[model samples]
Target: MKKTLLVFGLLLAVNYMFSQGCSDAGICSINHGFQSEDKSFKSTLELAAIYSLGEADVGYFSPYISYTKRFSERFSFTSKVTYSTAHGSFGTRSQFGDAFLIGNYTFKEKNKKQWSTLLGFKFPFTASNLKINGYSLPLDYQSSLGTIDLFLGTNLHYKYWDFNGALQLPIVNLNNNSYFKEYGGTNDFPSTNLFERKPDALLRATYSLKTPNKKFTFKPNVLFIYHLGKDSFENIFGQRENIKGSDGLTINGNIITSYSLTKQSSLELSLATPFVVRDSRPDGLTRSFVLGLQYQYSF
Candidate 1:
């Protein structure tokens, strides 16, 4: 019985690791480190292919380009642009994704431990005016929610491990062109989604490994996110509708592999999958696989 208990405990620990990942669904970058690659200039090009089955069916491909520049050892800036092509059973569409920018500052370092903070903003670029057969497409079919978001986070690095946490608040999310009418056909005219979103929080931990040849590195991580509840929406019929069941928790396990082809160039691949979930998740994710390939160059 003691042996069986020990095995069960080990399994539990593995399950929890996947839940602590630092990345989220909206993130497009593949660089998951605590600092800016410890260099002065870095350029990254990444392509992500995501297949989401089950309740939400989608095939999405997004390309991300990022440039991180360092002025000194203590501070760096990163700017990334993204575009996506997506297809579903209903139809196909392509659009530019949200713009992502972040400034990183490292502070509080002593005894092989370092702390870094990230302050960033995402600009609104996606348009939500999508309709098929004269009816509004479901929210899942829209490529982006068109929100300007602000982000703040910090990372703690100790040896070969990193603990990262972040919060994202959507300050402005508005798309007045199309409206999703209430189900069951209420007595109100269709109105756009005018509700403000709650803050989304994430926590992740990553452990890095280097190959004996010093040409490759492996990183495995766990991520967890808590999506807070949404606000109420005012309808065209002078009524307020409270959207519920939209708050929940999710956990994912991700692995990233990198190979250095040369001193200035490298390639990376990443995979993420969710394993556990809880609470009322209206329009929640059932299961998904995000596969990514990234090429990096530094000079």
Candidate 2:
């Protein structure tokens, strides 16, 4: 009975993590480019939790918050913060935090079909004290590379359809060299020369239909992502190897329904699924199903 209860609890936690943002490869990207009219401030909050079943039991939970303000008809600014936790059956756990700043500019005139461009930077600040499968990994082992991301994207909005696309470039990387040397089992510590670069590109499109009363709407969206570059690993004993691979691509789709509760409040539910995956890295997991709920308020 005790074992059964523990299993049930773990399942619940995994489910929560899945909802929060567990990709099959353990990477999470939060998309929040949906926009609003000018001269308005919008805020949104979301939460997701997940669990991994089978021989290897793992669970994760993540919570995120975002705020955006439109300064003029053609410009806007956004800020976001997120926290995440991960746990494994062997009693290992890890946590991380991320923040982002974004600026958007419109190239077309107001009330006309136009294109908007977005530029952004992401800062990953992480601290973890967790064992990996009972092995005492250093606190820095679980940290991200602390990268600076350069974003360039354009959004096209028409009466019934919308399209968005972006490319992500990593301009700077800051990681503890000793951590990679120890874990990767090489003596290449303190040499930043062995570092590599990775980049990503994304494209998304959506179609929407509004109800007669204009209080409810249905939207279907499709997203495509491609990953490029190489990751290097070295051992404390001075052995080194570079993992080189071609770009990987994935396609996903989502259906979302939104209902207006009042003039300034709305509720939204979204269901998403992975449609196509190609050239997946052996060590990475692909995203499966995703469900999300969001609440937005304007003041």
Candidate 3:
């Protein structure tokens, strides 16, 4: 039975390698509970590739590089950068996404329980407006949201279980162009020009199951996200209109599996799919599914 399950898991991971998606906003990238707790390692480096399929057949391919530095037993900092490309029927567009700088502070770690706080900043690298063939592309085709965002969150670990909560807020909004609105009556895309996005809150729970030899670990997690307020977009008449049904909840199920290759290196595979979705994702953050593969090195 164990061998059967292991083969099934491996097959699933390989099949999903071509897609990736998650936390449509920014909270999903905060490195909530995956940081190394081993004090012996002063720093670690990670390289990850992700593929996501969104509504309207839009596809995203993102490559990420991240570095984490352990300053002390209870403090650490992480920095990550991503380059993304979007392709679909409209064409292809690629650019640098947002950059993330996160700090984690542990408050307690005793008797198989740990508590930590997270604070981070998201710096935009693009204007969130990309043009293909002289046509404005939607948010799904853009790499960045073009906003300076603040992230605050907390994580609690008890034995093999993990719980996390977070909030992502835009401190500065720079996305104001009408994405694909210029194409107008010629296309079926939604109006996202001068898009104004709202804040999002996240909650996640996960359980880790490990093999007897400790070489393999499987983590299954459920993620919940709530859009705080309705998003708005400028209409052709030059008036801001609220996107109805935009403020709602989304629930997703995710699985992450890891294999230890050596003392200093490992490989991770993750897949995510939504169980519940909101009606209007005007921010163009909607994802049908996400898959990722990552390699990590520690020293």
Candidate 4:
């Protein structure tokens, strides 16, 4: 009975790691301890590929690259870029997505407790207005959300656990051109004209574990995101109407596993899925599941 229980516990941990996907805007991946304290390298570069299935059978593929530079023991900066391609029943579209620039500063450190603060910006590449044959596409089809956002967050770490909180606020709204009314009965789409998205508040907690041999690391995490206000859309009369059931909470679970290849290189896999979703997700951020593979090298 003891041996059987041990096997069952191991299996459970592995299964829960792949339960959900990671799409918490940009807060979840920052400050994940990619830098090595024992090594002299102060910079790291990462390349990643991600795949996810979205609403209406839409499939998305994104390629990502990021560079992190540690200026000091307590301060660092990261820059990231991504390109995305999406296809579904409506059509196919591809473009450069958003970019993120973040800075982190460690404020307090004790025996086993540490605290850090982060400030970041998300910039869009386009006007969030993609079209097909003169008709505007929905949010799901556009590669960029086309909104400038500011992120204010902080992190607390104690022993093998971490807690994070952040707020993502749209400073500028450039997503006003998505008009999905002209699908011509062939496709039943949501109303997303001149879409206005609200702010998002997030909270997350995670636990990290390492193998006895120190070659593999497992981190299981849960995330909560709450839409702060109702989203709105422009109608035919140029009046903005609030989208019903747009503000609510979404819960997601994720597991990240990494294998150390060398002193300065590693491979990581991340899987995520939603445990609970809101009523309306017209922003097209809904994903049935997300899988990501990443490679990192430090110098």
Candidate 5:
């Protein structure tokens, strides 16, 4: 167990340096660079639900679902959907939904992980409606912005630790034009341009410790995110002007524990905290606390 813990700790250190070094150039943000890989031609499902409570904000809820299936030892595909809604005393109530698809590939043999790559495409079908102080908005405000995304990513895993990252680029940005014209309600609204570079990169690293029974494991992870681009979140309802050009850094750490219930079943729990945040929007919402639970079954 001590050896496992040491290994994971080293991985975490490496991830931290990798993320920080990106600012020097020729390096990528950690969020989109490093991620774990599961190489089974099997199906994995995830269901996430979250609720936030605060001052006048009252509360907000989000429910997300994803399904992933591997076609071969090193090839896989995934699909996901998310629904979110919020109500506030500021006389604001809104709801939004999105759907996406992704594909993944591994270059190494098994989990050796010299290099693993993932390429994906996402088609977003978004529908949203908002009301402030009990007043109706324009029709375009309640419609969908048809758009697509292209993503490329890689992961490097050593004996005791691993690094994962990815980059997401927009391929079809029709949604931006539609949103600006509809939400901005002005002919001078910004135009959708694909040549712009957006900050959609991520990186993460984790180390693991095994218990004497081998059935129990503990893992600590660190994560970072960078949002780049001029109009990245523009047109998105509720987004503040400060969030634009608001490129900075955020760091989060999580500790996860897993206990084996049986050869085919296991229970997992995680606790996390946002340890660092830079240039965070003053009005932006930050995660205060997170709790995770998962059950696994194999056939």
Candidate 6:
């Protein structure tokens, strides 16, 4: 089993795999580009449910809602809120994932090409507590990192293809308050522990097409990522589970389809899976499949 540190002070110290099930390193569940400047404002609400499993674990279920609004020809804003419930050999825990927000601006355009940059942040908000079985759960199992992070992103487009990337860097470092607690005042730990995390980055590209009849649109995406590592709590005997290999490379592919139910309503579905992996993943953290569905309307 390879070991490494997590980023929330590593991605929360988070990956939803949109991404928690698929990328987890903070790549969007759905790539929303610096779309063509059009409407004065547009809103999208997406509901996504995804599942994943590793070699040693059985499964995780994460359901979430995301909203985006384009305020003008060059600016847009987006946010995502999620709840994750994990099951299998590790037991069960349902907690709120962090809330992520982004503000994007398109700064350049030429013919059919456009470029934009973004700034983003994540907040520590949980729907449930972090500790389970009287000890702090590992980073992957918890939702919020209990700190704030900053994001920088850029997007470039040509014809029907989009190239985009982002960097997630934590400006604050703090650990769980319930990281570990002692029994009846034995060799003790605190209700809260302090930990440090780093940054994670992603690069992605895609090509899209529409049916001649204007009834359906399809997009295929490719994403690559490298997340930094760190060390955390020791085992029951106070041995830092420091095994190393927390950082690595991952390649993913996804196909997205949309069908219009009307002028203002539509149905969307997608499938994303990682087909390539290199280097040791921390604690057997392998790639899994993610399927999603979303309903959208605009006013």
Best model per TM-score: 3
Full-model lDDT for every candidate:
0.62, 0.54, 0.80, 0.77, 0.50, 0.61
**Taking the tens digit of each residue's C-alpha lDDT, what string does model 3 give over 1-299?**
46745754565455444333334777865754345545788888999999888867788899999988999888899999989999987789999988999999887678888889999999989878888877787887888888889999998889888888999999999985566455644354568878888999999888788999988988877789998999888888889889898888887777889999987888999887776778777776777778899999889
Tens digits of per-residue lDDT, candidate 6, 38-84, equal 36338766677776664335466778887888887778898888777
Candidate 5: tens digits of C-alpha lDDT, residues 108-136: 65656467777776554442224354443
Clashes of each: 9, 22, 9, 4, 17, 20
lDDT of 4: 0.77
Query: Number of the top candidate by lDDT?
Result: 3
Residue-level lDDT of model 1, residues 185-266, one tens digit each, is: 4322223455444667888888787888979887777777787664345566757665664466777767778899887778
> How well does candidate 4 match the true structure in TM-score terms?
0.89
| TM-scores of the candidates in the order shown | 0.79, 0.71, 0.90, 0.89, 0.64, 0.76
Candidate 4, 111-162: lDDT as tens digits: 8888888888999998878877776788878887789989888888888888
Task: Rank candidates, TM-score, best first.
Answer: 3, 4, 1, 6, 2, 5
Please say which candidate is ahead in TM-score: 4 or 6: 4
Against the correct fold, how does model 6 do in TM-score?
Answer: 0.76
Residue 225 Cα positional deviation in candidate 3, in Å, after optimal superposition: 0.3
lDDT of 3 at 50: 94
Candidate 3 residue 46 C-alpha distance from true site, Å: 0.7
Question: Where's the lowest-lDDT run of ten residues in candidate 2?
Answer: 19-28
Worst-scoring 10-residue span by lDDT in model 3: 14-23
Angstrom error of the Cα, residue 119, model 3: value is 0.2
